[model samples]
Target chain A: MKKIFLILTISLVFVFLSGFNEVVASATSNFSISIVSETPVETTVIFRGKAQSRSYVTLLKDAQIVAVTQADPNANFEISLTGLSAGIYSFGLWADDTAGRRTSTYFFNISITEGVTTIISGIFLSPTIAIDQAEVRQGDILNILGQSAPSAQVSVFINSGEEIVKTTGADNDGAWLYKFDTTSVDLGDYSTRVRASKESEISDFSPTASFKVSKKSVKSKKKCPAKGDLNNDCKVNLFDFSIAAYWWKKSLPKKIKKRVDRKLYRDGKINLRDFSVMAYYWTG
Target chain B: MRISDLKFKLVFSFLFCILFFVFFSGNILAAHLYFKVPENLVGVGQIIPVNVFLDTGGEDINALEIGVDYSRDLLKLKDWSDGNSVVNLWMERPGSDADKLIFSGLIPGGYNGKRGLLVTLNFETLKEGRAGVSLLDSSEMLLSDGAGTPAKLSINDFWFYVKEGASKLESDKKKDSDSPEDFKPEIDRDDSVFDGKYFLIFATQDKDSGVDYYEVKEGEGGFERAESPYLIRNQRKKQEIEVRAVDKDGNERASLISFVPVYPFWNGGIIIAVIMILLLISSGVYIFKKKN
Candidate 1:
């Protein structure tokens, strides 16, 4: 009876000790992943965990492999994610060999920083540019417009193959402008491309616009003289004075006389003023 | 059961807790440098307005300088000048006081802020072409605030591009010529106008003699003494007047003469009205004759 009691107590003690050991092992084995980062962006992504893996770990979002690491074996791992957009992510680790097919996966939230939006369509930079007019004359300013991420560099190239003007930034609406140096700019097809960029990305080009600089066109028509034109030649000369003297004293029809009177005097009367006007041009 | 045993247990637990807190309680925030003004693509000659924003506990910033790297064959800088901060124009390396190419003003308080510093930079292009302006790198010294503690942190470098000019010219004529050579002879002509359009003349003067003339022609024979007295002779108007010095080269190099037309108000108006009346009479006469 004594022997059986001792055997029973030893067996019970062994069983209780084994159960306690298993509990400790299970506590260490079971793990969960928690994301300590805000979100994913073009810049960076940081993560932390309650149960981390240092021995041969792989990070995944869905099933895509993001990173593999061998550092921070227990519950802390920092994965660098540059140029990655914001999204949901999951990471997993396996402490066992191929023979032991058990894997631990951690799911966490991540956010990616969205890149800045921009409008850089039609901006030009050149020293000398032609006007859109048929004949761009010298001293005609060329207006170039473009867009960027605001406050971009803009310039105008001159005929000397040099930049004549520089603008610092765009307006609140992201529009930039620069004027042409019309002084040395001749009438020709001057070409330029306005470009803008932020960091590494290049903005789109503005449609190529050209100006035709030429000498001012001559007008075919002329304005009337202050005193009326009696002969009506395009000159204020003796021809006008002679016609006024002919109608000086004639009492013609109302409209006709009025027209004659206006020719003799500036204000419309056949007076001594009419004779004087004729005398001034008598040499003709 | 003894007081000493109880005191030992308490002390051990307290010591362990302090170590854990010391090791893991502090927050590690990241430091980043981002642009403030130009959020993106900027015009070539625009005085690049810039603001360097720092988001972190105050960092020990040492020195900051903005640099632009460009293709020598494509674009060139003439001058850079401003009263306060030095503007460095560059051909290969940036040189100060060359020409009005770039102007720099010191960031108000040297720009150590959480948001950033509003530092305005005005840059003018000497020629139009493609290039880049980079934030480059900044140097800083890490030091403890006080209490004799050493500062510890990592420094990260950042960079961005500044498009000097549009790439259309570069992409199109990339294979034409590397750098701006003498205008191609095929394209170069005595037209005096650039690109078959602009007329460029130089008013040159002798340094010592003060003799001035318009360099009408090119090569050796193009220059004619402007004082030849017959510089401007109008046959129709019988007007002859010698301009003092229309030198087309040297210090007096300048643009050729240009004219704006004069309008004869009264005379011109009368001619137009008369022409209109004559047209009316002719039309009326034709219609009357046809009716008859």
Candidate 2:
């Protein structure tokens, strides 16, 4: 009778233990997955969460793996996404532990708001002017070198004129040079300014650079100024003689002919003879 | 002694039966099916993704059928996908007939887990209103206990509001000329025995018009649309990776990793040479045998 009681007790304990094992084996733990992200995500999004440590985390969109990462020691994971088109996207976060003992799959419903297209105003810097020859002869080629925004179209204007005298594109180095012929321009002082433009954006004109176009200067001839009017006064007097005396014995070049005549006149040399003529015409 | 022993046996059996029922029955009742609808503030014409899930609790669920109802006038079903679902065999692929989404699938050996993703449904807001999403009572979940007993499921419905005045959507239409700022990406190579993959991560800001997207290409392949913290699938030998950051205004900036050698032995040139030598030897043997 004692043996029977003991046997039955052992059997019951075995049955209970086996039942407990079954329950434990089939028991499932709580797995919660949450995504913290701003709704109406535009071009990029970040989804972060905590999961089983060393788990394989996969982010899916339209049934394709868009991004993937692994959880760290603290069971924290983060995924960043960029360049998404404006539309609704069905995304899923699936995590499988390294031991393959557990899996948690969660789906998220998100809407990608249409991104706003924006127009950007570009910065336009003024160009610089560097002339190779500041003073050039007429009909000569003037090399105008300058720097502006890289790859910008530089318009070189002459004499501050509205018309663009020359147009050239700046190289990748932002350096440009224009060969302008001075033949069309009048013989006088001229100034040039340049502006750089790219697409629709135009920069301010550069500082003006002044240059001279040198041509032979012509002198006007006057009638032989009445004997001793060396001072160019209508009446010859002591003042004319004083002016003549100041230039006495001075040799004049062929281009400069004096009007006063005395003995040995027409000679290139200005002597006492020219002074005596001025004295003779003295009315004072 | 005999009478007392008989009484004790009977009591013990009764207690065992009660304990078994108490523990097992609770497991059977824990299975549930529901929709996870995030409270979303959307604009008219905006598309949104919604997910349906099955919480097995502790039960092994083999098959299930779900029916979702939504407002037809306020929303339009755009598309749906069953990829990455726990069900291996699908009895019915998720589809939308007007405003309702119907789905059913079978999982062999049943799925024993806390949660399983069923399907992802995409819907576009048609107008400004509150769109209510709920699971119909006709939805059924079958247990994997071989008898195909129906599992009890609790349904939770949620609402999403589609408003008319979304200022952000209104402001996105202008042209933005500011190029995305220059950025340097961090590249990490994995040579560990378990994972042999490369990870690239970087972040940049576009003050004007916001950043639109990023693109990455390895070797000579065409640029693939990608994002920061992206993974490179190639684990072979040396290759170049180029990444471009593009803003909404079509302005772009790029960064490149010239050469990254993940595996030293996986050389294309050596592989081709070996293949050529094998072909030559095989052809020579075939010709020699024919002559003999």
Candidate 3:
């Protein structure tokens, strides 16, 4: 009886040990695959997941193997695919342990678009260009103002010329201003437009703004005539007397009196004294 | 013997649990970048707007390169815009050659959000057919974590159908008939310096179709394209100014204001001469009285 009891205890111990080893082996052999990419992939996609260490990862599209890679030290695996055509694609990811003790297969459906790869949408509008003045004198400053895409670089083309005269960047509010010196521009009508660019995109040219550059007007500075040249025609005649008679008794402002001869009229009135002075040097 | 066996089993069970946990919990979600276009039937000759955006999935990205492929025969690249992009600097300006569009830019501090637009592309349909826009594999997004690590991105392409004789075009034409609301313009005058010139400032707003341009006329001068704050030639004379605000659809609203400029009494040359003569006469009379 003592010997039989001893044998039964040993048998129970051996069975328990074998059961624990089986449980461990089964547990370590378990692996799984999870796709980390968003659905409806265009031309490229990335698959990432976890698998047993030193495991082989195979990616199959429509039952054909496309890629094979190995999991990292931490049992993390990733697969990337590119240049896929447009159609319904069935992707299957299978992870096989190095010892061939475990394997996992994950299936997913991806629909690729035909023809175009990406469709981008947003607010897009043609820019507008406005000038400060429609006409400017030679040697004056011409200010170009306009609105375009925010944070975009704007180039101003003068006379729609091949050369870009000025370049400026638009502010956050999409407003931009550029000042061009008209001293170098010839005296004639010229058209100017602007276009905005950012990254690889260039916007359409803005509407042209036409402006004229006129020749600078010259003012002749000549001394006040001997007396009656009120019109500054370089002659003291009846015409000058008529101008003096028109203001016979009126009170004149200081600015106007300064322009007139102070010698004839020291006081602030136009009377016979001024007329007499005008008559003295009259040349009608 | 039993104690040793129990100890070995405990250690083995712990190791198995650790391996299971590591293998099952190692997945990290990545960001997504894709295109968005109208899915409805677009009409031939219609302008279609497409948007490229980034769904960061809570990652901060600083730089990106996007390449798009399309059918050039069915669609003509009209224009593109970066109006709503978060990137401030362009490493490569967005452009298209034939059927491919490419763009590259960088955001200063990085962007972390959902559905951030990168660019907008406008295309005109050339014929009735289906066209696909897809992302090329060369596209890349760099994380903002100083290492410039490439972010894992899953891209999605889009397909659009163009049809002949679509009703959307008729609706767009009908919208043009709705005239822009009439708005009164405010007038301002600038006469600080007496250079014998002043400016008449007029400003108004058009809610619909935006103000195309402005036309202004002084007196009998023909209506000319003039911006607000028009320069008047004569400061001391009355100016009959008429301003019209024209909308994009060619509808116009006009406003007229008469400006009568007044100069100070000191500005008159004739008035100053008269005052001087009167003063001289009074002085002469006083002198004659004293002499008598």
Query: Against the unseen true structure, what C-alpha lDDT does each candidate score?
Result: 0.34, 0.59, 0.58
Report interface Cα RMSD per prediction: 39.2, 50.2, 37.1
For lDDT, the strongest prediction is 2
Q: Report residue B80 deviation for candidate 1 (angstroms).
A: 9.4
Clashing pairs for predicted structure model 2, backbone only:
A83-B213, A109-B49, A116-B172, A117-B172, A117-B174, A118-B175, A118-B176, A119-B175, A119-B176, A120-B177
Q: In model 1, which regions exceed 4 Å deviation?
A: A1-284, B1-32, B56-112, B125-131, B135-138, B141-292
Model 3, chain A: how large is the TM-score?
A: 0.34
TM-score of each: 0.17, 0.28, 0.28
List of chain B TM-scores, one per candidate: 0.26, 0.47, 0.49
Write the residue-wise lDDT of candidate 1 on A112-229 in tens digits: 3333111111211111112234334578665554433344444433333444445445543334566654667655555554444433333333223444556662221222332335
Q: Which one wins by lDDT: 1 or 2?
A: 2
Model 3 C-alpha lDDT per residue in residues B42-146, reported as the tens digit of each score: 888988877778877667676677888877778887766554355433434466554467776655335666777677677888998887778888887877543
lDDT, residue B107, model 3: 52
Candidate 2: deviation at residue B195, Å? 50
Ten contiguous residues minimizing lDDT sum, candidate 3 chain A:
A116-125
Kindly report which residue stretches of model 3 are placed more than 4 angstroms away from their true locations once superposed: A1-284, B1-27, B169-292
Model 2: per-residue Cα lDDT over A236-272, one tens digit each: 4333433333344455534334343332145555543
